[model samples]
Target: MKPYKNKINRIRSFALALIFIGFVVMYFGIFFKQYPLVMVIFMVLGLLCIIASTVVYFWIGMLSTKAVQVVCPNCGKATKMLGRVDMCGHCREPLTLDPELEGKEFDESYNRKKPAQSGE
Candidate 1:
């Protein structure tokens, strides 16, 4: 079985990872102390990563406001959900707002817009 996580949580994790990567990159810059230009470049790149992470965090905040808050049937905890299918943050229970999708296997692709199909 595929391990699934709340969409918001996944994005948040990505943002957190970016921050760590930024710090790691900056730490490497310290090793190039003998070459001023190279050290400067590394520092700049690291700063950029941090900035990008900050942007991603801000985006997550915006998405949070748009997501639906519902109590998970399995976990009995309030969880935020986005798109057609989402998992409970607390228990990893699959959730969906669409009645048609109820009882069906969870598929993330359902959230994406599908192109019109022509008759075969």
Candidate 2:
């Protein structure tokens, strides 16, 4: 199974990646100094990536405010969760709001509209 990360943290990581990518693209553009047009294009694209990251960061910041804050039982630290199932940000422990899901194997489908079933 794929590793799970809190939605907020995952989104934040993506935004961080965008920042890195933007800087790398801009740096690579420096190699094309002789071709001003190409260099400018790369610079502009990189700037757009940075701008997109900023927007994503702003959006996630708002979404974070609306997330449910709960103390992790395993780690005893406060963390935010967006859906019914998510991992603890501090300890990576699986957590769920539904009592039925407690102690069950962590499954992303638990957050879906339809109830998760044992048999697929």
Candidate 3:
């Protein structure tokens, strides 16, 4: 099966990983302390990663506002859905907003086109 994840959860995980990578990069900067310029470069790069992560977090906040909240039938919990096809946050069950797409293959592409052009 194609690997699918709750969109919000996946984005959250990505933000978390970015933070970790930022720290790791910053730590590596210490090794270049002998070369002050190199150390500064590493530090700047690391800081940029962290700042990018913060931006991504802000983006999530924006996306959250646009996400639809639904109760997952599989897990019976409130979850957020982005686009048309998304997996349940709690149970990873595929869910869709379009009736015609339900019970059919789950494809992220389903969310990309206008319903009128999707050929149903």
* Model 3 misplacement above 4 A: 114-120
The 10-residue segment with the lowest total lDDT in model 2 = 111-120
Residue by residue across 2-108, what tens digits does model 2's lDDT show?
88898889999999999999999999899999999999999999999999999999999999999999999998999999889999998899989989888898988
lDDT of 3 by residue, 24-99 (tens): 9889999987899998888888898899999999999899999999998988999989988899999999998889
- Clash statistics: count for each candidate: 0, 0, 0
TM-score of each: 0.94, 0.91, 0.90
Clashing pairs in 3: none
lDDT of 1 by residue, 1-120 (tens): 899999999999999999999999999999999999999999999999999999999999999999999999998999999998999999999999999989998777778898335473
Per-residue lDDT for 26 in model 1? 93
**Candidate 1 residue-wise lDDT at 33:** 100
TM-score of 2: 0.91
- Pairs of colliding residues, candidate 1: none
RMSD (Å) of each candidate, 1 decimal: 2.7, 1.9, 3.2
Against the reference, the lDDT scores of all candidates come to: 0.93, 0.93, 0.88
